[model samples]
Target: MNDWLLAPTLQGRTLRLESLSEVHAARLLRHLDEETTRYLSRGAPADLSVESVAGYLRALNAVPNRVNWAVVTNDGDVAGRISYSEVRPADRWVEIGTMLTTPFRGTTVNPEAKLLLLERAFEVLGANRVHFKVDSRNERSLRAMAKLGAVREGTLRRYQVRPDGFARDSVMFSILAEEWPAVREGLRERVDAALR
Candidate 1:
């Protein structure tokens, strides 16, 4: 099994994915709010204090199975975060998730981040499948996943309970290794167009 504990920094044309660090905590705190955390059942904690965010970053860094990264723009500003979890080396699969600041929501930050992450997962990590499980209520997220060329697998009913005690359905999507070549080309085109 690959040790995702040691995360590698992933660089792209307009953004970089660095290992989650305390330095990013303050910037991350600025983006954590009810609206940002709504669809995420295990989203950032309610406390937005710098200290709390730092502590959370520390804890995330300590985890051995999950790998997290802070998304930074080319100009050196933190934009958001992305992570690979539920990594199973034997199965060669991982789940990708993100929490982006409002400013980056409709921008290319997310698509670029996912492009880099998926490249690493499929090309470097030898992952056979890269998947996502999004809250069914989040239509935006569902559409975004589709835009990435991931096929919707199915929906898991009552898959999770939110912080607000609401039962949430999870919509699953994935891109298999066999399907990666076309997906990669599509993503590369989108990213190239965005960069232009």
Candidate 2:
């Protein structure tokens, strides 16, 4: 666990965000469907197992300057996971990422979960910026970032190597501290509309 930051349980109208643990492994493992795994760096998750996922979640605790959360729905089902990494306390910034199941993709969970995370980063943690990096081919994630009102700061070509040894581009997006109010309100409106 990092001294500067610890994962906090964040609540929203439609869902809850709690620090991820092995207890969530089975449900999170089930979220590893083809549609949801394709865009991820691991790509299709060939050898994924509950134990492997549990270990993965376990290892996350030792990662410096990063925090992970399991998104739980009102129904008590595990929706997926969201995390912010590349956290620089001195710089007061973080890069957020998500891996939600296909079922929750277009629902209130995404925005409200993001609302909670962004709220923590900006309002609670005193971060000046929160950024995202989406695989260029992942249109769904790209759209999510745009919908969140983050500015697209261009792409980094061939930024990461995929599990299959293929290179992929990453689209950069960020929200500055000055822009949080508008983005937070937009997310709230979307979340509220989805809840209704």
Candidate 3:
């Protein structure tokens, strides 16, 4: 998929994913707490200065193959960021990752956002698969992925080295195009229940 074309806003009932921009840096900074950054390979930024955040935003925009979005509430508050990366058009697959703000966690925000992103990946982008890789030590993430109907593929030992210089194993999970119908229905149900 063309990078420009793939950047369209994906909207849901309570949230929207808009193309990531420098303007979002400030709002994003407020949410990247120690808890949020603990599992991120890059870890937390040593400095949360405006300039640093802007630089990070610029770097995100420069990536050619991936599209990052600022996850914002319907009322326009930025809640976090998510992206489709490791995009392989020929293979018709992509990997999704990133962190959400604490307030949005365990809420409908994540399920609905994933619903929107997965729909765009399978329906709009014609992806055959969408995958996620979480640090193997992260039980919460592992459970969350399972709840979403993603099949646990296996673990990759020493798959990534964190900024702290520690090698981390990654737990892989995926949902194939053929499984999208069932996965989508389940996610919709979860979102509905969450809203209620």
TM of each candidate vs. truth = 0.92, 0.92, 0.93
Best by TM-score: 3
Backbone Cα, N, C clashes tallied per candidate? 0, 0, 0
Cα shift from native, residue 180, model 1 (Å): 0.9
> Candidate 1: lDDT over CA atoms?
0.83
User: Worst ten-residue run, lDDT, model 3?
Assistant: 1-10
Q: What is the C-alpha RMSD of each candidate to the true structure, in Å?
A: 1.7, 2.0, 1.6
Query: What overall lDDT goes with each candidate model?
Result: 0.83, 0.85, 0.84
Candidate 1 lDDT, tens digit per residue, 125-190? 888899999999898898898888899999999998876788999999999999999988988888
TM-score of candidate 3 relative to the true fold:
0.93
Candidate with better TM-score, 2 vs 3? 3
On lDDT, the stronger of 1 and 2 is 2
Tens-digit per-residue lDDT, 1-196, candidate 2: 2533788788888889999999998988766677877777645444579887777677765677778899999788899888886788888899888889888888898898899999988988888999998999998888888888999999999998987898999999999999999999999999878768
